[model samples]
Target chain A: MAKKKKAFDKLQWIAAYKSFVLEKGELPATVRELAEMAGQTFPDFKKQFTDLRQLETAVIALYFKEANDLLMADEKFEEYSNKEKQLAFLYVMIEKAGADEVFLQEFQRLKKTDRGFAVRLMRFLNRQELSWAELSWGASTAERVGVNPKQAALIQHALSTLMFFLKDYSEEKQDTDAYIEKTTDVLYRLTDTSTVRSMVDLGKFLFSRRKTTFSWE
Target chain B: MGQDKIAVSKYQRAGKLVNTGAKVGANYMKHYAKKLTGSKATKQDLEEENAKDDYSAFSELKGGPLKVAQMLSMGDQVLPKAYVDQFALAQNQVTPLSLPLVRKTFRKYFEKDPLQLFDEFSTEAVNAASIGQVHKGRKGKQEFAIKIQYPGVADSLQSDLRLIAPIATRFLGLKKKEVAPYFEEVERKLMEETDYRKELQNANEIISGCGNLEGIHFPEFDPQLSTDRIITMTWLKGLSLNDWLATDPSQEDRNRIGQLLWDFYQHQFHLLRVIHADPHPGNFIITPENELGVIDFGCIKHIPSDFYASYEKLMRSGQEQDSPELIDALFALELLHDGDSEKDQATIMGVFGSMFQLVGQPFYSETFDFSNDSFFEKIYSTGMALSKDSSYRNLSARGSRHFIYFNRTYFGLYQLLHQLKANIHTGQWTFIAA
Candidate 1:
């Protein structure tokens, strides 16, 4: 029997895969080649990743994982409002991706090969539910309960930010930073219901103050 | 905290100006409509209404127009009293950046959150600067004040001025061509004010040059913690000049502080030849020990050698109504044009001569009492007369571009002293022979 294969850490394999791609400027042609380059046996590599496609997906997932881990590591992360939490995540991720030219180039190639890659990746990242406030409207009894609207918004924001980051060429990507700040502000403001409440209040005030006129017809 | 978004885009800012213009136009129409019916409304009433609308618009659009309003109001000679009173409120009405935006700016420059960089950082701003906001932070035993510039202020400045040009031309009742050079000078200085690195350099220069001036204090800046948009400096604990005045200090203490202020400006003007052009009360602080704390060094004007020589000559030729030397100096200073007809030249000289005599009174004497309200009243009446004089208005703004901030410095300094009501020896500087 073949020697019992050692347990292989997925993150270690992803790191090795990244170094292999960066050094050679291309992905290995086969899992065997990647495993050999990483100085690991095929059996151990197979235990961690089924094929090159899985490994490739894992690499992109690792980026998001690391960004999330960094955000979670911050002591103030728990205290931040949901909007701030989203902003911090975008800032951290964009800054990290911008600094890694090699990764960005690889990401571009992957995007060309798979048009749905970003959407699928965003969906995967959005699996974890956030504790967002819910909206409800009723008079004593609940008539309608609003679902959390942040999931779709955050996914859309993340994807657009990634696309913007790829094209942003401002010095130190400052324009991208400004874009993120402005868009995030507008997005959160759009979701806030205070404007709608104020509009209703204004409408009631106008109706109450309406002038009643009597004319002989 | 609630985010109060400042109008940053050129279009949004321009739209605000358009609104003000329409409102002002409406006010004029109303005034005329009332006048046609033989109503008792006067032009002064119209002016007061216009000034209120203009200030409301400027205060909303904070960066450039409000700054121009403040500068126009500072001289108290250029604008009517109603306008001066209304625009003076722009000094403290700047909107502050939100906490998230502040964090974003910090991350952009330092690649770390402000909380991570400092041992303790306040989420809320302590005070608002013209182009930025200041937050208090502490590291171990040392306290700091960090000024963070609002986003896109520098980029939007040109467009802001472009939008304000037509409005200013109409408001100041000057031809657009006449306002161009002065606006250009103001635009250049406003651009410089946006660069915190230049402010850092200015602070360092002033501190090194006047470090030994008694009873005057400058903050210690940390370059390592500073960036192009964020300035980190040691916090100077004190009340603003207005606040200090409200404390009901003794006349002796007031005179002491006033003397220090006078000497500070004199030293910078004469010896260093580079003066802090912004002498607004907000830039000053009175320490607990009654020492003067110069908090801001954002607007430093380096007097040109030629301008200085001519200015010195003009001051020395004082009380001589039409001496050739005085005319020559005035010509050199660009206050009188060579193309002016003899009558216009004489009229201009007579006006400037008396104006200079009254303005230069403090410098011409060993001691002067600023508490004498009649003196200020005379200066105000002279200014009002000049504003109303159709002959003076016909002549375009004749002085060199340097005169804009230079006159502002003196006017602001005089106003500060007047507010203090402090009598002190004013002829202490050697540049002027009393």
Candidate 2:
């Protein structure tokens, strides 16, 4: 991927936020919202980008943060990581826009305000949700320990989810301990053979345990 | 009296004798009454027609648990011999695996034909089980046994079960609030049985659990060949328990082999909460070394946390009989019928108490000599007689959802033991101490 350009200074970044509000017809999202859309504070997120646009460049990133919070609370994601969190967020976004007519309507109403917001939001929406892109996650045997490309990819997907789900994940606090422990387990299992193999039941075991089922219509 | 009244008919007497509550008998009457009264269709005549219908439906469902129907058919033998003869025409005519149906299922699941994936596949099935059939073939250098479940079997499960059940809520009854949990359990276990994936998990878990133990063995799964409808595993060697017993093995050999099954189950309960819930003698094969090769991992019941607590309590009781604890255990299992009368509860408990005594029999002594048919006959006769009691009916519906397979499995194991005439070390081989 080419390095994304068009960096914004703090004020220009503030102006972009203004433009976003002017177009979106909502109050300028709070700094807490700005610093926390990806569930990361601005300082902690700087490794990915130095400028404020890194946070505000994408309007759907804010929406991703809001929905990702809900997905995090779900039982399935009890022990997800940052990469996994992002992919899950992406999946939610795609499934929501593709399948939910009402959500698409609300999104369209906001898009009518400006083409720029519309284009960016549309691109982010479901770019890969229903696609067989994450087939690895869809139908895979247990994760192999250490660094097979498959394991690395799966772990990256998990880590991205954590980075995008739990705000202040790096903060050393008692309350944050739950999130920490969960991510640790998911990460550890990504590298643990017995847990992965046993749970997956390897290549053949997956089929015998499954009932003949048609996908949801 | 001026004139003798017309003699009462024999059919009239039978109508008075049979229970109106038994819908099956009433249904039999209603069907036969038409043909019997009509010159063209007597009761015997109607049975012949019904037999034809049952045969077609059985073939249609692709073997829809017709064995349950077959068992009920045996009970129907008490009817007049002519009626029994007509009913005997019903044959479990299962069709062999057709290449087209096999291809369609493969394409539907994998987006490709089975022939493309599986080379040198067998169209003929070597054996049939409750849910489906198994075909022996080769995927490559590795030999495989591909299992194909009949089509549309899942849709017919509820109707098939309702048709087989002695009493539905319509004949007997259950609480309105209680229906959801009760049927939810039956549907769940049956669904589990339908899922070949769950079976694969069970196969692996069992392989992991007791694979290394001497005189105890099971098959390892090869996953690429498996799907939701089909299970592929490495071909296993040896004859099943029924085959071995038919050969008339010596008492020493029978006892040693029986000990392996007992020990294997014991190891599962203490080491893993999973219980192998299938009891068909064919599932257990005897090898040359006398090692028991257990196949067919289709029905497995994993003991949930709550049930384990009850099990712990039941195991703790020394007298080998504790009514309150057992009821508590049943409660954990969701077995207690919510609106059962005291008489009903006691009768059900009495049945359970007898079985507890039987299972615990081995715990008291060094070994269990199952060659004695009388001991098993007592248990069987007791269960069958208990089953006939009107109030004890619908008890299965009231029982815990998860425990259905587990409970059925114990009866199956005892029956298997009796048939094998195997003597097993019950006290040393199980969780009786715990």
Candidate 3:
């Protein structure tokens, strides 16, 4: 009779996967190898993940989830403005990523070999970020006319920041921190309705003046 | 309203200073154009325009260049009133670090969030320091003032000074070689100011040295809680000197506060040899008990024995205009260089002689009335006359690097006293001639 199949939790598989990538300096060639490294059966690994790619996506998503969980745990998180929430999330995510250098290294390496996987991971992350942004902005404001553009800009910002973080070599990655602060500040300023409102006011004045000039002509 | 975010990148900061240079060049072009058109644009008008442009840029940069501007403004004798007026504004307009950034800095230094370390930490900065912002924090019954340095300030300082050097030389009307030492001096002090650990050590040294001095107070620093980028000290409860002056304190009160200020500086200069060289009003506080509070020890200048000897001689001989001893001391201090021609020497001696005599008047007296408008008028006119004098303009910069901060210290002290309108005894220090 075959040995009884032991059930392994998803987190245990993730923990095993992260250490394998860190130690071997590459992802396991097959799920069987990862399960064997973790002293578990291949069926147990298959129970948690469909493939190594799915496992990779889950590992990346775990960073986001952990970052979000940390932010949500903060009592002040609820009181934060939308901009502050976004900033807090970025800072916390970078911090989380910083703590897991092996995972980031592997993620960067995977991006070079598997562009499709990188895209999928980014879309997954973006969806998570967008939902958070919507929650912060409230459904009503999130559905407003200009917010979609702002959300699009924010997603692009998040992507660029991730790219920047991968290349950041400053002491304590302070350059990345400063970049996030400055760009987010600019984005919020650009999307601010007051500026749009003023432009509208100017347009009205210009149109009224043009009409009067036409009448005079 | 949100605080203006600081220009953070090296390129961004460098661009701002470069923009000032371009603006100054544009101003000059405009001045000449106005002249070609026979417009009534005097040199003063061009200078005022240049100064305004420079100030706006420095205020925006708000790190090294802004500091240099403040130091230049304090040496009111070297700059025009227009530049002085504009650059003096650099003292107040600093953009604070965001709350998240502040927490990030705290975490970097302390390995924990500010809120985690303190029982109650302020999310908003209570005040802005030159290179950092001050936040109030509390732990149980203990209240603390925490100073958090802006990110990349230290790293960018060297580049900022490099960019400012040429502009500074032009603005001061001196050769690059002539201004190098002063910039070097300012650069060193500014670098030291960015290191909070050094500042904590400086504060401790000053407090221990001047701790026995009457009517003055210092905050107890917490070294365990302090780091290179953040300083945690017991919170000082007081009004800033300017605010204290606003409450319309009596003449006696002003004199008392002024005496304490005078004694505090004199004690540092005479006995300790290391002085809190930054004497700006913001660095000082008048406690609710009306005692003097010295809050910042960031820019402490340690006077070398040789320099202090010459300085002492200069002060003692300053009252004697045209005296050989005074000229000898001036040469010793490098205020009169060996390369100077007789004409240049005479020009420098003539201007600096009368200037020092007036500046040294307080030391000459048992008690000097700082409120005497004529006294400040003489100083201002001497400065104005020196700036306008063509012969003086031709002379190269001829002062020791030490003089940059040394002159700043005295001039700032004089300005503070003048603002206080206090009459205080100045001949009490041990170094003064009997």
The most accurate candidate by lDDT is: 3
Q: Put down candidate 1 lDDT per residue, B142-181, tens digits, no spaces.
A: 8999998866667666778888888778866888887789
Model 2 misplaced regions, further than 4 Å: A1-217, B1-64, B67-93, B107-119, B139-141, B158-167, B170-180, B318-355, B387-398, B430-434
Lowest lDDT block of 10, candidate 2 chain B:
B1-10
Clashing pairs in 1: none
The Cα error of candidate 3 at residue A138, in Å, is 4.5
Chain B TM-score in each of the candidates: 0.93, 0.72, 0.90
| TM-score for all models, in order of appearance | 0.78, 0.52, 0.86
DockQ of 1: 0.16
Q: Give the per-residue lDDT of model 3 (tens digit) for B1-434.
A: 25455577778888887788899999999999999999999888988999999888887677788887887777454577778888877876676667767776777778888888999998878888667888999999989999888766776677788877886687678888767777788889899998899999899899999999888999999998998878999988899998999999999999999999999888888888889999988888899999999988999999888888888888777777778888889989888988888988888878876777778889888999999888887787877877788898888877788877777888899889988999999887756332
Estimate the TM-score for candidate 1: 0.78
The lDDT, on a scale of 0 to 1, for candidate 1 is 0.78
Q: Chain A TM-score per candidate?
A: 0.69, 0.23, 0.76
Best by TM-score: 3
Better of 2 and 3 by TM-score: 3
How do the residues B82-128 of candidate 2 rate in per-residue lDDT, one tens digit apiece? Answer: 43343333322344433334544565567765556767666556776
The lDDT per prediction is: 0.78, 0.54, 0.80
lDDT of 3 by residue, A1-217 (tens): 6575467788888889889888888768998898887888887888888888888877877866887788778877777677777777777777887788757767578558676986677555555544545644443333355335444455567657777888877766767877777777777776678888999998988898996766855
lDDT of 2 by residue, A1-217 (tens): 6444344444444445545455555533455454443233545435444543333334334444445555656554434433344334444543333333333344345445565653343343333131112232441223433334543344344334333333332222211222322333344345447776787775456577455433343
